[model samples]
Target: MLWETPFGHYYGDNRENNGNYFANDISNFYEELIKKCNFRIGEGFYVNILKNYLSILKEDSEYLYYFKIKPLISILECEQYLKLSPNKEVRDLYLECLNECSSLYNKYMNVAR
Candidate 1:
């Protein structure tokens, strides 16, 4: 499920029993899996999850940018507000993800245009 928070939009698995946010059957499946991992790995997992989607949907740059890539970037931007104190490993991963996302924005935004 996708929620519009004060921070930004976020994806969820509808654990709250409100409803599931499925754009389509298969796409939602992949999104749900990525979201679960993101939560488990404490948000820093966004890098690996973004990579997974890139590989899995090799020809779908637009989808990756709009769904996985953009949302993850927005989430990271809200880190200061979230006030999360991640371990060293997670912090490193988050930094790497930020760097990669910057490159990805350049690469994918052109495709989107």
Candidate 2:
């Protein structure tokens, strides 16, 4: 259900009145994801939150429609960036995250069509 709040109108889960508020803007939504992570990337926009962000995109069709840029383009940029990481550990993590991101992106694109 939809409800109006001081922040704005939000889509709330009908199961619970105290359900989470999903922000309409990408920046606000990104902030909420960051709050749940232990490690944060100082540089790079979507790369830092690739997996989770794409997962959110798959779940919210409305968000994908209004997003400024195609998420896969950003994901491709991140893939190029992570590909150059000299460190084996970072590269390893990148590979894992990239796989999940690719899957999520596919799901999102299919739904979008």
Clashing pairs in 1: none
Best by TM-score: 1
- The 0-to-1 C-alpha lDDT of every candidate, in the order given, reads 0.52, 0.51
| Backbone N/Cα/C clashes per model | 0, 0
Write candidate 1's Cα lDDT for 27-73 as tens digits: 55556555554475664554576455335334344535546656657
- Structure candidate 2, residue pairs in collision: none
Model 2 CA deviation exceeding 4 Å by range: 1-79
lDDT of 2 by residue, 38-76 (tens): 233444443546555545445544434435335654654
In lDDT terms, how accurate is model 2? 0.51
